[model samples]
Target: MVSYAAENQLVHLLYARGYAVMRAPRSGRVGLPTPDLVAIRGKKVLVIECKSRKTGFTVEREQLEQLKEWKRRTGGAAYIAWKRTRLGLFLKLADVIKNKGNVGKKFAEEYGIKIKNEE
Candidate 1:
């Protein structure tokens, strides 16, 4: 069971960025390969898988593939949001896919987008 803290934190952050965010209810148990959170601003849509950890995390291959498919079908951007410390870091889904769904801290540091308080 994933904690609500990570998802809620992301929701607030996206809201501050002028995006409307929606979190999946019982996301893990949904059994449908849906993303943890979806945020939209104007014509841009973001499908994100949220992870909160001290170091790194791994997304299942099946989940990664489904996320890719969802992006392809919806024309939305996909990302892995990792909260390692105080703020969340956004990593491109394409990068994760290339790495086989494994996100290490080093990889995140190299590729993660640091979200600022002001966009």
Candidate 2:
């Protein structure tokens, strides 16, 4: 399916986990680094940049930077959800990925949270 579909599904999963979520306005037209998803559960807040890549997931420097700025400004968390294979893997915005490299289970263990079982 398309990346937008992945984003929508991710939104639902976040809601199920008790985070109030909203899909940001389309970024290309908005001309801003708005994250794909914004979620808050009680005192916790997150800005998520979602990706659905066939190859390893890679985050744009600008995207990650903006997410970092958001977290810095809000004193909350920022994450990148690499929805590569329904694993629902996530990484901290500060985490490094060298040139399109995929995150390993260690990153998953540290930052990832499964939203759905493998399908």
Candidate 3:
């Protein structure tokens, strides 16, 4: 499970930038998975799944597929925020994870998204 504090910190960063953000509820009894954060600014919508790199970037297949489906259906960009890094990494999930165990650095680097936070 992703840490609430990490997700909260990421959401706070977006909120500081005047972006509207909401935390998606966990999928337990609901049986439906949702992105970790839903951020909106103007016409930009970010379906972000927040994770802490301290434990490595990990995402569920169902969540990833749902995010992709959301993009296809809603036209919003989906990203996996790899938190707790040197400057944090916002990886735009290109597609569903193939025959892999985890979403590794090489795969994330392919997105070419390097968001530097103002320290």
Candidate 4:
């Protein structure tokens, strides 16, 4: 399981950027597929799965597949935060995460989540 600290940091970054962020409910009763983090900005909704690097930058294939299915079903953006490195990475990822449509497309095609784009 990812640490609470990493999850908290991710939430903090999202919240600071005017996003309404929340942790995924663990009860599994919501029927709304619980993502690791949910951030909404205006009409855009982003669902993120966070992975801590306490072990390495690795994620289970099953989890990734599940997240992808959730994104497709919810019509929301889905992302994976590989490591809790710095606030900058969090901020960068948050930006991409907030763009649900584009991010969702990229995630579905690539099976990889990307951050930091050239400006």
TM-score order of candidates, best first? 1, 3, 2, 4
Total clashing pairs for each candidate:
0, 0, 0, 0
Can you tell me which runs of candidate 3 are displaced by over 4 Å?
A: 27-29, 55-58, 95-101, 109-112
- lDDT of the candidates, in the order given: 0.84, 0.71, 0.72, 0.59
List the pairs of residues colliding in candidate 4: none
- Report RMSD (Å) for each prediction in the order shown: 1.8, 3.7, 2.9, 7.9
Candidate 2, poorest ten consecutive residues by summed lDDT: 96-105
Q: Per-residue alpha-carbon lDDT of model 2 for 13-118, expressed as tens digits?
A: 7888889998985745477667778899998998887777655444566666788788887688887787766467767666644323345556556666665743
Show the colliding residue pairs in model 2.
Answer: none
The 10-residue segment of model 3 with minimum total lDDT is: 95-104
Ordered by lDDT, highest first, the candidates read 1, 3, 2, 4
TM-score each candidate.
0.89, 0.76, 0.77, 0.61
Off by over 4 Å in 2: 25-29, 97-113, 117-119
Alpha carbon lDDT at 91, candidate 1:
95
In the range 38-96, model 1's lDDT, one tens digit per residue, is 89999999998888888677889987998898798779999988887686789999999
TM-score of 1: 0.89
